[model samples]
Target: MMNPESLRTVSVMRYILPLREGGSLPALAEADDDFKYVLKFRGAGHGVKALIAELLGGEIARFLGLPVPELVFATLDEAFGRTEADEEIQDLLQFSQGLNLGLHYLSGAITYDAAVNDCEATLASKIVWLDAFITNVDRTFRNTNLLVWHKELWLIDHGAAFYFHHSWNNWENSAKTPFALIKDHVLLAKASKLDEVHSEFTQKLNPDVLRKIVNLIPEEWLQWEDGSLKPDEIKEVYFQFLSTRLTNAELFLKQAQDARKTLI
Candidate 1:
């Protein structure tokens, strides 16, 4: 398990360029640590909740022993936003002045193509299981979100995962909801070990690990507009949601297995 306290914090040295492909409008920025990262601004169109989902989902990927790019907290200075002439980008940067999420840029990485590349059954199964567990609906073949770096597959762009939290009203019931989107998962056909992976991950991702993952969210991101729940209470909500999902894993596990059988 990754130590939540060990997450590195780096200051933005320069705003390199904008990656306009994403809805959040993430940018490639050079950080104080002399490393270049794809910065996901908190004030982007999707809002801070998207960042929270990314952190929680990405950490889960790491915990499951999947290959994910290193995530860091990139500190952005107000001055960085001022240098941009684009009004929209400037506004986003200005709003995201304090802290944002950064994904380490993988040089020479190519987008994953299922047609040409062969994924190991175990790795593919693990990813399928993780996406199913987190309710991530973005990893379909059209937008694999998987990358090939150093001859290894790496997961990225997890902002769309855990979407249930966007509207927390029915979160408890949502946890037990069946993940129907598993049918379109990029690795569905390749996930031959779904049963074994499901059993192992269920046993490994205990409450302790889930709590540690939820604790990783910065307090500022937990602020609710209604102000009904305190930060600690909000964290507990997340823990409960995930715990509920784990306890009700059979529904999703069966869904994935059924999807795999159809594909094979």
Candidate 2:
């Protein structure tokens, strides 16, 4: 695993690319590599908590063994002196303009739907639920936040996570929020196949790794009316949700194993 601390040394340029309709990641080309990596610029004036959340979230996602892309934390340097009037508007694009490397935009040899749905049912379910439990704000149908690499689904774009801790701890009025309407969405229904797949793995989460992740967050990152949340709370909540998911997953798997029932 790449050390999370190394992200601070990534040399990012200031050239802004056009913002996609859905995500905050600025399009960026990795230095000297033919391939491009999506660059997410930290808001010019973000707090330590937000920064911590961004870094730790990526680290934890990888440690959890999810199909995430390799994350690199980079910075704006002199080669990045060029900027549009809105410095923050797509400021990460210049890094990708064939700097000896050709134009390599986001593309896959295959499409996301090509991944064998039945075979990856568990993987699909865990990632989606992890996002929901984390209250990740991206990954909607329009943005999906996934990439097809080696004919497998690889996750990308995490700048929108931890939105819950920042914006919704006391959000009792979930009905008023956009999330309330998704309870019975088709996506959720389809997720059942994944739920069944995931049930087997919930109890398998590496507790030691999870403990390290929760503790690694600089206490300031967790926010609530009273202040930041205790690390135990975060772990506990995650554990409970994942455990429930495991139970549900087992039932689904049992049904799938039985020839009479089809995988959802």
Candidate 3:
């Protein structure tokens, strides 16, 4: 696993095309390293906090033995926005002139379709456990956000996870809150042995690992509406939330198991 502190920074060399699949309106761009990356703009409508979720979620997933595309900090130049004739994209690039998030593009990767592929129950359980842990409500059948590259499943587009950060006014109060929405998770039906998966992953993801992953989020992206918390203070909240969830995983585990039983 690449140390979160050593996340590579790349410079955008060329603006390739726009990917209109998600609400963020991420675009394809070639970086100075001669690699194509799906660039997530900090200036997107979702704001910088979404980028923080992506960074934190991707790193956490990677640390937990899940396959995620390589993440890089891509530096954008305002001139690239001027080259874009589309006014919306031009404005997007204009505001995202500095640091942004990039996912190393997976060439020829196909969207995961449950109808065509059979996923292992254990791995599906692990993924479900992860979504429950992070409170990710985006991974429904309507939007899998999963890719099949080289015959292996790769997780992508985690900007919707870690959503509690959006409202930190009651942050501490929500630390151990149950994620009731996991029932809608795309992999819920295929998930089995979730209790065992929870035990194993909770042990694997200790406070140290959570701290490292939280630290990976750039301090700039840690801002909120009213600036109630400093960067370091907000970062600590992330660790506290994850730790509290892991310590209280039973609530969600049972919820998932119950949901599975209903389906069965």
Candidate 4:
């Protein structure tokens, strides 16, 4: 399990370029550590909730022993991006002045190509299981989001996970619901060991592990439009949802298995 304190905080030194492929306009920026990171702005179209999902989903995947890029708390200075001629990007940086999420940039990584690179059944099963558990709906063929770096598969762009939080109602029921979108998963046809991995994976994500990951969420990110719940209350809801989802893993596990049957 990742030490909850291991996630480092860095300051954005320079805004390199915008990665337009991402709907949120995440940019490649150099941090004070002299390392490049893909910065996800809190003020993007999805807002801070996307950052929260990125942190939660990425950390959970890391705890489950999946290959994920290093995630960090990236602080954007108030004066940053002031000279940018583009009004859109400048406004984004201005609005996202405080805190953001960054993924260590994989310099030469290529998008995962299912047609050329063969994925092992065990690896595929674990990834599919993780996505299903988190209710991630973005790992389809059109946008695999999986990348290959140094010849190893790495997961990225988890901001789309935890869709239930967007509505913030009946969250407990959402936790137990099957992820019907699993049918479109890039790895669904290859995840032959889904059943074999279910027990072992579930054992790894105990309550303590889940709590540590949820606790990593920053209080600022929890502020919603209506402000009906306090930050701590929001954190507790995330914890409860994940814990309850784990208890009902069978619901999604069976769904994945049934979905796979239709494919292979």
lDDT agreement with native, every candidate: 0.88, 0.45, 0.86, 0.92
Residue-level error in angstroms, candidate 4, position 55? 0.4
> Distance from true position, residue 261, model 1, in Å?
2.0
Candidate 1 residue runs with Cα over 4 Å from true position: 1-5
Q: lDDT for model 4, please.
A: 0.92
TM-score of the candidate numbered 1?
A: 0.96
Position 58, candidate 4: lDDT: 95
Candidate 2: regions farther than 4 A off: 1-8, 13-16, 19-25, 32-35, 44-57, 83-119, 168-187, 192-200, 214-264
Residue 109, model 2: lDDT of 36
lDDT of 1 by residue, 1-264 (tens): 444444689999998889766568899989988999999989987788889888898998888778888999888876777878988889889989888999999989999999998899999999999999999999999999999999999999889988887777889888998899999999999999988998899988899899998999989887768558989998998899899999999999999998788887
Residue runs of model 4 more than 4 Å from their true location after superposition: 1-3
Global CA lDDT of candidate 1, please? 0.88
- Return the TM-score for candidate 4, rounded to 2 decimals: 0.98
List model 3 lDDT by residue over 1-264, tens digit each: 444555899999999999875557899999999999999999897788889889888888888888999999999876777867888888888888888999999999998988887779888998999998888988988899999999999999999988887765676556676788998998899998797888788878888888888888787677666677888998898889888888888888888998899888
How far off is residue 202 in model 1, in Å? Answer: 1.3
lDDT of 4 by residue, 21-88 (tens): 54589999999999999999998988998999999989988888889999999999889999998888
Write one digit per residue (lDDT tens) for candidate 2, span 189-257: 345454443544454544554555555543333443454546567545534433443334444333323
Order of models, best lDDT first: 4, 1, 3, 2
Clash count for each candidate, listed in order shown: 0, 8, 0, 0
Candidate 1 pairs with clashing backbones: none
